[model samples]
Target: MYERKPVQSWLTDMDGVLVHEGQPVPGAPEFINKLRSSGKPFLILTNNSIYTPRDLQARLTRMGFEVPEHALWTAALATAQFLADQRPGGTAYVIGEAGLTTALHAVGYVLTDFAPDYVVLGETRTYSFEAITKAVRLINDGARFICTNPDVTGPSVEGALPAAGSVAAMISKATGVEPYFVGKPNPMMMRSALNTINAHSESTAMIGDRMDTDVLCGLEAGLETILVLTGISTRTEAERYPYRPSRIVGSVADLMDEI
Candidate 1:
């Protein structure tokens, strides 16, 4: 029998698993502290590409969790790494905020609107009609399309707002070209995260709140997946999925003793 090794490293989602609605879930801070003190390799992952890791670190700090910048990973970073690998020093027409722009710039990608190599879409609070129109025309001309994630809606105090996935769909409908998603639910994102921390699948566990993105990505990456019920998917909702996680827990607080 080919048995897998025990989990020595961890990857966890941020929104649902650790924090929800701009607040830290109960015991979330303690769980992070335990991981930090134990010297385990872990990354706090998020699909939101609007803010940089430093910005996220500051947000988490305000929520009473002391997460370092290096321990934070975003879809923007993964997408940037993918683009850099696919076409080093390539040009792109991007419609996103500081996070996405910063990552692409760091990877030596030149952002432009004139006959660029790719049309990269990411999350942003302000979605301009002119920018979307430009992206649509650019893709129609010959640029490849890439998106950071497939999340259609994002939560806000007001309600759910259209996100990058929604905008990508609009552009696709207009140009008849689909974007290549590089975030959660795509194993590439998980692989990039693992590579960032030099962690192997056999000894790593992925803890997420959603069955679709987090659990699916982790499973596809050959890592043990744990679904926590602190966010989106409930135990009943999870049962409807075709695939199953390695285990289910009520919250991150439940796994504190293991660390």
Candidate 2:
């Protein structure tokens, strides 16, 4: 067996690992503070495209966590970067919010339903039937489809709401077109994050609570993965998957000395 070296760079999921339901998880603040003080590059990754990095930073700050705006990496950012690389100055028909639209605009992507190069789908509080219909029609007319993440449902103050993945499925059903998801569970997203932080997979570790997205993404990208039982996934549930994380811990609290 090849001996793996100690992890240097870190990539962590935001919601489950660091905070839960907009509240800071135990020891999350200290762990983040350590990462910041250690002079190591780390990013709080999320598949949620509803809010931009600044918005998310504010949300976290309000929750008593001190994550900087630049420290947050979102699916919206990854998706926009992918689009800009694939087709610079491309036009898209976006069915998302300011986070998604702003990212695309920053990359010189124009939002239009008219002869668009891509029919982009992202997280939105309100999935307007009119907007979805326009996206479907645009795809049917030869627009390539793209989705931010594969999560079908997202939690709201009230309850679970229909997310981008849910609407993407509906559009696929109508137009017989499947979207290319650019978020977690996609190795592209992990590689893109690595590029952003200027880190190598061999020395980086990914910390997440979900096996399907965070752990899987890191594993596929050839990085060591740590699963924390602080959110959606339990130890028993994680064992059911064929893919395994390098380590399992109770929460971010336990990793205090590791950093």
TM-score of each: 0.98, 0.98
Each candidate structure's count of clashing pairs: 0, 0
- Which residue pairs in candidate 1 collide? none
Cα shift from native, residue 10, model 1 (Å): 0.5
lDDT of 2 by residue, 201-255 (tens): 9999999999999999999999999999998899999999999999999999999
Distance (Å) between predicted and true CA of 88, model 2?
Answer: 0.2
lDDT tens per residue, model 1, 110-131? 9999899999999999899999
Instruction: Give the runs in model 1 whose Cα sits over 4 Å from its true position.
Output: none
User: Residue 15's C-alpha lDDT in candidate 1?
Assistant: 92
Q: lDDT of each structure?
A: 0.95, 0.92
**lDDT value for model 1:** 0.95
Task: Determine the C-alpha RMSD for candidate 2 after optimal superposition of all C-alphas.
Answer: 0.9
